[model samples]
Target chain A: MEKIPILRMGDFLLVTIQVDMHDRLAMALQDDLTQKISETSARGVLIDISSLEIVDSFIGRMLGNIAAMSRVLDAQTVVVGMRPAVAITLVELGMSLPGVRTALNVDAGMELLRESLNGHEGIRHGSNF
Target chain B: MAVISSETIPVTSEPDIVFVRRRVRETAAQIGLSLVDQTKVVTAASELARNTLIYGGGGAMQLESLNGPRLGVRLTFSDNGPGIPDIQLALRDGFTTGSGLGLGLGGTKRLVNEFAIESKVGQGTKIIITRWK
Candidate 1:
């Protein structure tokens, strides 16, 4: 019954993960995010994990899946505000989230998303699979 | 070596995994583990808890605070599900039976000071990991 809300800002969707997410919640967010992407035709997504203290391989994989899914749906995803400890642990866990983009904070993440959307718009549109 | 405190938590569903992590983190901190060590143990607990639920088909986790020559925390995860067929293969990185990244078992081993596992097909699996302060 508990759900993570997805907020829309112009052509982008912002998700701030404040809670320590469980498996079901992560999966639910995946479904809801992709559906929202399709419905809103969003150009980018920014996931802020500032408040998350722990991120294991499961959550790491979920972030990767979200990035891959967003790419397929013609959107870019930037995961921001990862704690240094979480980053070190993730690398040690052997999950680098290869496809997911990351930034230091929300503002930086938004800038990266906007830059990618505008500069590489033509290339991404043409390389659609 | 003596156990200062111990608690058993059931891992039946997704929310249970989160609870296990929180409890493990608190225990790790109480044992005087450094911030990095706390994160490592907590991350290891999260991985093992999820494995117990998803791969082992639900189980329980036992948390122990140790007071010996050194203070530490020990976690034991046990499941009565269909056991692993090959532990060596399972311990190798990038080998997964489920949709995960296959980092649970191997990575968890690396995060702790002591790691042990016992499993028998059709029986169950039990994993114990300890981190010293």
Candidate 2:
């Protein structure tokens, strides 16, 4: 598998994991995100987990941690491009990531990030919209 | 700020873990929380479930959903297994008493909007975490 890559995109930091599943990558991703969130104080973060095929408990928690860290930094975080298969595992494993925002694709996720930065009030509403 | 709703689920072991995670997400989704919010809630549930299995000696998970304007999910995993003797030690990263990578409590704490932990030597452990939607 390709190594996970972290990139800075404007106001949002994008972290891409090449791993097929959520594994110890959760911890590694957490560390990388925390450092970026702390140093730049970016208003938003987009974790591109599109490459991931599965999400286990550990990776789910790690994603959750990124959201929490972003909150602490006064920045918002969004998880973009998760495969449906991964979502199924997450649901099956009984892991809920309530604090993080997820978008079907990077564009949608980026749009949400912009909305968050624009001070949109209703963004906190559930995922159906 | 206050707990809105709480429920206790008793089941065999791993199977029940999935139930709690789904229920919390469903409730959060019903409240209009975003996908990101659902992920946080579910991730927190997974942590608690794993702990319940590994440390709690297979007991039950107490799930709390806080609503009204700002929504949040609070969950507690209580097991009569071997209690965590040192709360601080257990909270540290890379400190797993089990086969896990040791991200159970610490990672769960990071996943929620609000977090609290309590445990006794022989009794059990109670982890209270709230993730706002």
Candidate 3:
């Protein structure tokens, strides 16, 4: 019914989450992104979460799942624009989101995605928290 | 200590959890909680609401704006499900009876200024958490 739009920009897919997602919506997103990655053969995914005010463990797990799914499909995912408060809450929630690469903003996220696709293995933003 | 205002939000479905988060955010902000405090309490509400739906087999959250001692937001989630068998284990991080990160109870406690829980094996569970501004 309701869906977050996924935009294709050349070799990357851009997802900007602007809603306070319910659990079902979050799950739908994970499935949709995974399918899109396989179909489009995109090299990277850059999700902009600057609009999200909070991130619980469920949403955190969804992001981690999206990253894991894309990775298996041979695509890189860089989540960018996390608010400072969300980052703080996520860490305190005991989910460091290991293996889910993060960046400061969309520009940095695109750059990180580019670097990741350029054979620069282990291109993480130090600690995601 | 004393509630200035209160209401109960039913957590019967997935959308209800989002509603709970929104209501909690409004109450948190209404009580003049800092931006970061609002985020923390709202996040805590999300986790607990999900727990109510999935584990508690549906429940309700009593939202309260307090005025005694200090202005704050309080949320009390109650469910008449099987209830938590072991509070300590449930509160322990990395231990989940359900398919979750096991951060619901413990992590939620950390986000608030005060936390309390009561459960009966054959009865239900009730958790009350408060965040002061």
- Using DockQ as the measure, the top candidate is 3
Instruction: Residues B1-133, candidate 3: write the lDDT tens digits.
Output: 7889999999999989999999999888888998989999999999988888888999999999999899999899999999999999888877787575446478888889999999998799999999999
Cα lDDT tens digits, model 1, B1-133, are 9999999999999889899999999999988898888999999999888888888899999999999989999999999989999999888887787575457478778888999999999989999999999
Worst 10 residues of 3 chain B by lDDT: B95-104
Q: Rank the candidates by DockQ, best first.
A: 3, 1, 2
- Find the number of clashing residue pairs for candidate 3: 0
Q: Going through the candidates in order, state the TM-score of chain A alone for each one.
A: 0.93, 0.82, 0.91
- Every candidate's lDDT: 0.90, 0.70, 0.89
For every prediction, compared with the true complex, DockQ reads 0.64, 0.04, 0.67
What ordering of candidates by lDDT runs from best to worst? Answer: 1, 3, 2
Point out where model 3 deviates above 4 Å: A120-129, B101-104
Q: For model 3, which pairs clash?
A: none
Candidate 2 residue lDDT tens string, A14-35: 8777644324445666777788
CAPRI classification of candidate 1: medium
Model 3: how far residue B121 lies from native, Å? 1.0
Tens-place lDDT digits, model 2, residues B1-33: 666677888734655765776687777777666
lDDT of 2 at B97: 68
Per-candidate clashes, comma-separated: 0, 25, 0
Per-chain TM-score, chain A, candidate 3: 0.91
